[model samples]
Target chain A: MKLQINNINKSFAGSNNGQSAVEALKNVNLTVAEGEFVCLVGPSGCGKSTLLNIIAGLTAASSGQIDCSGRLGFMFQEPTLFPWLKVKDNIGFGLKILKRSKEKINEVVDYFLELTHLSNFKEAYPHELSGGMKQRVALARTLALKPDILLMDEPFAALDAQTREMLYKELQEIWQFSKKTVIFVTHNVREAVVLGDRVLVFTARPGQIKKEFKINLPRPRDINDIEVTKISNAINQELKTEVAEAVKELEHYEK
Target chain B: MKNKLIRLAKPLTFIACLILLWQILYWLKIWPKWLFPSPADVWLTLVKGFANHTFIWGILISLKRIFIGFGVSIIIGTLLGFLIAKIKLLRETVDPIILGLQTLPSICWLPLALLWFGLNEKAIIFVVLMGTVLSLTISVKGAVLNIPPILINAGKMLGADGLNLYRYILIPAILPSYLTGLKHGWSFAWRSLMSGEMLFISVGLGQLLMFGRELNDMAQVMAVMLVIIVIGVIFDQLIFGKIEKNLRAKWGL
Candidate 1:
C-alpha cells in the first residue's frame, strides 16, 4: 500500500455548553496502492470531506493512524484562487512558495496553462474567470506542485453540468498522465462510478465504510454507460437505506 | 468620457448653488462684511494670499508635518496591530483599549499634546499620531482576523510555513482592507494636524485660520478653510481613490 489508514475516528466538540459531542466519523480503515484512484461516496453529513481533510493534514483525526510517504495536494469544493493573483501567478503560487527558480516556475506555469487551456487567461484575475475556468486554474495550481497523491473533495460539484462533464474527461486524462494516487470524495454516485477504480460507500453521520466495490470497467468510462449506471444504481440503493436511517435518527431526536 | 462629465456635473452644480446662496445672504446684509464675508470676498482673500505667498508657505509647512506624522503612524500601527493579532493574549487584553481610544476625538489630544511638547511642531505631530495610530491598528487587526481560513489552508498545502504563510497568503489577502485603513488613517491625520496646528504652530494653514480670527477677518478665515477643503478633497479623490479603483479593477470587484 502506498497509503494506509487504520482505525480512524473523529469527533467534534458540541458548540453549546450542554450538548453532547458530535461524532463525525467512526472506526474506519482504508488502503490505496500507488497510482490508484479511490472514490468515497456518501449522503450529506457522512463525513466524506472531513475524512479527505484529515488525510490532507488540513484537519486532525481525533484518533487514527495514517501512514503515507509522499507529497499531497488538496482541491477544495470551491476554486479558492487568490483574487490578487492572475491565473498564471495563481498556478505558480505553490512553486513560488517552494522557492523554485524563476525560470523553472515560468516553465511549469506555461506548461500547465497550456494543459488547462488557460493560456489566454494568463493575466486574468480569479473574479474575471467563469466557475469552470477558476476550477481549472485551481487544478493547475495543484498539478504544478506534482504531488505524489491528490485529495479532491467534490472539486467539480459546483460547476454547471456541461462544464462538469467536460472537466470529468480532462481530469481523467490528467490523472492518467500524472499517475498520482487519488482519494476523491463526492455525493454523486455516477461521478464515483465513472472516476474510481474502487468505490467505498459510507454510512450516514458518524460515517463508517458500509461497503466497498471494485470497478472492473475499461479505461475512460463514460458516466452514462450501462455498466456505470448499473453500479451507480446499486450504490444508490445502499445509500438510500443509510439516508432513511439517518432521517429516522433525526426524527427520534426531535421527539 | 461623456459619462464622466455627467458625473462631474452633479457636484459642480451643487457647489455653484451653494455659492449663489452665500451671495444672496451677503446681499441681504444679514451681518457686517467682516462678520459674514461673501463668496467673492473669500475668493479675493484667497487670490491675495497666493500672490503674497502666505497661503503657499502655510500649505507647505502643514504638508510636511502631515507626511512625517502619518508615515510614522503607519509603521507603528501596522507592527503593533500584527503583533496583537498574532498573539491571543495580547488581542484579548489590548484590543478593547485600542477600540476605546479610537472613539476619542482627535482634538481631545490637543491639551495633552500642548502639555507634553509645549507648542512646538512636536506637539502638533504628536496629536496627529494619536489621532491615526489607533484607527490604523484596529483596521489591521480586523483585516487580519477577517481573512478566510481556506486561503491559509491553501497556502500551507502549497508548502508555506510560518513567515512564508503570512507573506504568501495573509498579507495579500488582507491588503484591500489594509488600504481602506490607510485611507481612514490619512483623513484622521489631516484633521488632527489642522486642530493641532491651530493651537501650537504659527506657520501652517491652521495658524492662518487662527490669525484671521484674531484679526477679525472673516474672509481670510473662510479662504483658509476653502484651501483646507480643496487639499483634503484632492488627496482623497486623486491619490487614495485612484489606488482603490485600480485594486478593485484588478480584483474584479
Candidate 2:
C-alpha cells in the first residue's frame, strides 16, 4: 500500500462557550495501493476533508496512526495561486523552494504547463485567467512537484457543470498517464463514480467508511454513460439515508 | 469617458463656488482685506511666488526631505513589520508600545527631535520618520496576518518551510496591503514634515508658510497652503494612483 491509516480519531475541543467537544472522525481505517485512484464520498460535514488534511500532515489527528511514505501533493477547492506570479513562475514556485537550478525549474514547469495545456498562458497572471484556467494552473503547480500521491479536496467543486465535466475528462487522462496514487474527497456521488476505481462512502459527522464500491467499468467513462449513472444511483441511495440521519441528529442536538 | 468628465467637472465646479463665496466674504468686510485676502489676492500671490521661484525652490527642498524621510521609513518600517509579525515576543511587547506612540501626534516628536539633532535637517527628517513608521509597521503586521491560511498550507505542502515560506508566499501575498500602508505613511510624512519645518526654522515649503505668517503676508500663507494641497493631490494621483491601478489589474479587482 502506498498509504495506510489505522483507527484514526479526531475531535475538536470546545471553547469556553458552553458547547461540548465535537468528534470529526472516528476509527477511520484506510489503505490505498500504489497508483490507485480512490474516491471518498460523504455529506458536507463528514470529515472527509479532515482526513485529507491529516494525510497531508496539515492537521493533527487526536488519536490515530497514518503511514504514507510517499511525498503528498494537495489541491485545494480554490485555485489559490499567488496573484503576483506569472503562470510559469507559479508552476516553478515549488522547484525554487527545493533549491533546484533555474534551468531545471523551467524544464519541469514547462513540462507540466504543457501537460495541463497552459503553455499559452505562461506569461499570464492568475487574475487574468478565468476560474477554470486558474484551476488548471494550480493543477500544473501541484503536478510539477511530481508527488507520489495526490490528495484532492473537491478541487472542481467551485466550477460550473460544463467546466467541471471538461476538467473531469482532462483529470482522468492525466491520472491514467501519471498513475499516481489519488485520494479524492467530494460530496458529489456522480463525480465520485466518474473518477474513482474504488468509491468509499463515508457516514455523517464522526465519519467512517460505511461501504466501499469497486467500479469495473472501462476507462474514459462518460458521466452520462448508463453504467456510470447506474452506479451513481446506487451510491446516491446509500448517501440519502445517511444524510437524513444527519439531519435527524442535528434536530436532536437542537432539542 | 463621460463618467471621467463628470468626475473632474464636479470637483472643479464645487471649488469655483467656494472661491466665489470667499470673494463675497472679502467684499462684505467680515474682516480687514489684509486678514481675509480676496480670492484674486491669493491667486496673484500664487502666480508671483511661482514666478519668483521661491515656491519652486520650496517644493524641491520639501520633496527632497520627504523623499529621504519616507524612503527610510518604508525600509525600516517594513523590516520592523516583518519582525513584529513573525516573532511572538516582539509582537506582544512592541505592538502595544507602537500603538501608544501612534496616538501621540507626529508634531509631538518635534521636541525630542530638536533636542537630539539640534535644529538641523536630521531633526526634521527624524520627526518625519516618527510620524509614519509606527503606522506603517502596524499596517504590515495586519497585512501579514490577513494572508489566507490555505496559501501557507499549500506552500508548506509544496516543500516551503521557514524563510522559504516567507520568500515564496508571505511577501507576495502582502503586496496589496503594503501599498495601502505606503499611501498612509505618505500622508503622515507630509504632515510631520510641515510641523518639523515650521518650528525648526528650516528652508522648505513649511518655511514659506511660517515666513508668510511672520511678515503678515496672508496671501503667501494661503498660496503655500494651496501649493501643499496641490502637491499632495499630484503625488496621490501620479504615484499612488498608478500603483493602485496596476495592483487592480494584478488582483483582477
lDDT of each: 0.92, 0.92
Judge candidate 1 at residue B237 and give its lDDT: 83
Model 1 segments beyond 4 Å from truth? A249-255, B1-10
Report lDDT (Cα) of residue A52, candidate 2: 97
- Candidate 2's TM-score reads 0.88
Q: How many pairs of residues in model 1 come into backbone collision? A: 0
User: How does model 1 score by TM-score?
Assistant: 0.95
Runs of candidate 2 exceeding 4 Å displacement: A99-103, A252-255, B1-57, B87-93, B115-117
Candidate whose TM-score is highest: 1
Over B88-119, each residue of candidate 1 has an lDDT whose tens digit, in order, gives 99998998899998899988988887888887
Instruction: Give the DockQ of candidate 2.
Output: 0.71
* RMSD from true fold, candidate 1: 2.0
The 10 consecutive residues of candidate 1 chain A with the worst lDDT sum are A245-254
